[model samples]
Target: MKRAYGLGTRSVAVLLLSVSLAGCGLPRSGPSKSEILAGSVEKLGTTYIVPVDARVARAASKSPELGFSADFVTADVVGSDVIHPGDTLSLVIWENVDDGLLASKGVNATELQELQVDDAGFIFVPYAGRIRASGNTPETLRQAITDKLKEQTPDPQVLVSRAAGDGATVSVLGNTGAQGVFPIERPTRTLSSMLARAGGIAVDPETAQITVTRRGRTGSVWLKDLYRNPRMDIALRGGDVILVEKDTRTFTALGATGGQTRVDFDSPNMTAIEAIAKVGGLNTNLADPKGVFIMRDETPEIASAVLGQAGLRETQRVAYVLDLTQPDGIFNARDFIIRDGDTIYVTEAPYVQWQKTLSVLTGTASSANAITNAAGG
Candidate 1:
């Protein structure tokens, strides 16, 4: 009887120990507030935490300009119909003399259908050896050719016109109606006009991202912004590459929200409340309305503006907290804007942890009673 009693007590002790150990490793939606503040130090590319308020929301609301600069917007459009190398010129040469240098049988004029301008910007004629036609306009090239032929054939008249040729053009690619090279004509000289000529953006205009690359530099703007801001309708240059694509900016939803996902921007701008709705709102059964958090790496300028303190480090780590339980919490959230790459987190209710502990303890007690009975039997 003494041995049996001892076995029962030992079993009870072991059962209690097991329950305590399991409680330590209880499964959770995410880290608690205290855990985030303590363990997040020097971890997961985050190092600082800051609570958000109305003032911080206003100061940090200013987003970076994502459109054309003064240099691009203020630039004057290039001359229309500028000649370039490898252009095709059609010329009709006429002479008063019946049997002229460029005339045909019983005709006072002759036609040259395709005169391909060489890589060296020179075109060869019947009598005029070779004349540069690259940089000259139709009128100037006609005058130059007339001068060349008038020396041999008296009083020559020439008419010059451009045909389909490899001239000033831009390449439109990626998520556009027509992905090909389009010449920069009078109708398609600006960024907006060129996009229209290419059948506009294939993706939704609200989430469309247009990138223009000229020379070696690149600039980008949202399609909505391009139409809203006239300054963003920059001039297109020769050999510029325009890429229309869907917006890739997204924010991560984690913790006790309805779902955890990396959601793309569906509109030009998204507020914090909209972001919450986007992730299917919080899990009311498990969420702490006061523990909502948004984490991001802010620029030094924005960080100073938000904290009203200068001389901060480059890209300061920040955490904006929102308490939906407050009368004005929802309003503050509505005012707060969600920037790119922000990670939103919601903490679980404190009582949820207590419930897990009690559950483990109840199971342990039942197991202990069974062990005691077995020992006695």
Candidate 2:
């Protein structure tokens, strides 16, 4: 009975130990409020500004409401429906059914005219010598022509149209399959429609930026906003060029991360914790959970500037090391935003690296031996 009781006590003790060990392996509860607040203060004490391209700045400088004015209309002419360059005409009697006036061939519906109005914003027509076309449309210009023709030709019937060359075109460049001049047919042409005509954005998702330039006025619009924000899709004008560029910059995150290898969040503003989640989350067995190092190009100049702003001593460097094991550490992860050229490194427990190295070596040796045997055979 004594022997049996002693054995039973040992078994119970072993069972309790096993249960305690199993509980330890389970995930810890999330951090508390005080912990998160402290982390936020430590991680995001200052604002970070990323450098934007010069073209981007120039593009934003112009007024959003640009080029919605006159001076974009065609000429007004009688029988000379077509507006052409260097065409002289004779304005004569119309009521005298016997006047030596001949009907001029009207301009075609498709001819694009490049008519230039004088300082008075008027085009010189045949019978309607000089009439304003800058702020008027074809139908409106026709009425003005009819009024003027009445002076020379009695009740002269004047037909007005685009007259000849009126349409203007602009170019679309960069990251597009088709790069060429796009004609401005309508008065208000949108940016989205233009991009669609140029064979849509790239299949592989990337950061997209568009630069618009017209009459020395320029602006840049983010590609994301072109779809998300309705207001960003502004009307385009003639002589405006659009250049769309892809987002190529990326940072790498490695070790015990959500993903074991490289994870491309694609933005410099990605936080350390966000990057980890993107990869897959921490590997329980291997992750140290405390030492998270964000290795960056901490040049002396940049380091000094950050340090000066941070009010840190010379001994301290800009490269930051964060601990996520402490309960409050999770909050710091949220506040810590990544920069353009940063490498996030999550260290592992001491045994983790050795185990990984051994696994890799074993696999390599096995492959090598198999290849050697195959060659001999």
Candidate 3:
């Protein structure tokens, strides 16, 4: 009976040890890194895993919505600086003698008159009557006045100059040192010059964005890009509204990275590698070399093209994988442009999970053995 009791006690201890070991080896509650990567390709849902390569990078880089193009900063449709409504013009008429209609009785035989362009686009003159000045340059108006006065006087000399006009004016608003209507007095007034006149960008120029609204269409370009590409500093036009905005696009870094937080791009065209570097790179001790991922939400058209699928719903989420262990991954990362509101996740090494599980089991086993030995004593 004593031997049988001893055997029963040993069997209970063995069963407990077996259960503890089994618990240590049990599958983890969450999906593994491999499983997550696999799900990216299987079309299990809206999530996709696209492998980064030269071909993939080239394709992805073609997205027009990702970055601003120099094409948008097109040549300013050059227009003559003609007079517009709500303009005040100063007119000077020099008559041959003091008997002309424009000549004052005793004021040096010359007429100095200030006239404003009416809402009907006409400016009143003594001999020219109500002449259309809205679409005419000062020189053209001067010639028109001379022609009109020719009927009354021989070779009447007239001068037309803009006192106050909207012809050379532009509206500058938002993050600028000065926000108001600025006149393009110089013939070579470009975007940069106008911005300087407006007291430059109020925010950090490196992270600033300038939006140019011409006519009814609006386009944006990064301030840094404008500085780098002189051509992008297109000539400014009348009625152009320039808005200086602070950089708002940002990406979040998660998992095993040096720092996990939201990172802002200094420019609109930031690459995946640049983003990683901005956050102090990956956490070498915990990061898996094979599991660098950029998670993004894509439009249906882009998602379909990327996943090679048809008839997918709009706004699909995808994970782009980059294996830093591969030789070409570095180059691909340089080419992979990071868009606004993207999440970069660096997965943990596979061994890290196993090691954690093993450590917990070892601690539990040691505690159980200590209790058992004490009981036996």
Best by TM-score: 1
lDDT of 2 by residue, 1-377 (tens): 66655555555555455445542343332222233334432567332222112332222112222221222211111121332222222222233234423443342112114446544556766545677665565567667867876677556665444522332456889877688776544422677777887887763333566777767756665576667666667665546788877655566776556554555445424666777777777778766676565655544344445434454433322335566766657666666666555666666665654565555555545555555455445
Best by lDDT: 1
Off by over 4 Å in 3: 1-31, 38-45, 65-80, 95-106, 109-114, 149-157, 164-168, 224-237, 309-313, 373-377
Per-residue lDDT tens digits for candidate 1, residues 1-377, read 89988988897787778776864688898888767777453566465666667887887767876887666778777654677887777889999897877777689999998899989989998889899888888889899999999999888899997763676788999998889998888788899999999987899988999998887788999998999988899987778899999988899999999999999989878999999999999998888988998988889999888867788778887888888888889988998999999999999988888888788878887888888887777
| TM-score of each prediction | 0.86, 0.51, 0.79
Off by over 4 Å in 1: 1-8, 11-15, 39-46, 94-100, 107-109, 118-122, 127-132, 139-159, 164-167, 373-377
lDDT measured at residue 123 in model 3 versus the true structure, 0 to 100: 88
Better structure of 1 and 3 per lDDT: 1
Worst 10 residues of 2 by lDDT: 71-80
The C-alpha stretches of model 2 lying farther than 4 A from their native spots are 1-124, 130-140, 157-160, 163-168, 175-178, 185-187, 196-206, 214-218, 254-269, 279-286, 297-317, 352-377
Q: Candidate 1: global Cα-lDDT?
A: 0.85
193 Cα displacement, candidate 1 (Å): 1.8
Write model 3 residue lDDT over 157-195, tens digit each, in one string. Answer: 887877546656789999998999977665437888889
Provide the global lDDT of candidate 2 against the true structure: 0.53
| Total residue pair clashes for candidate 2 | 19
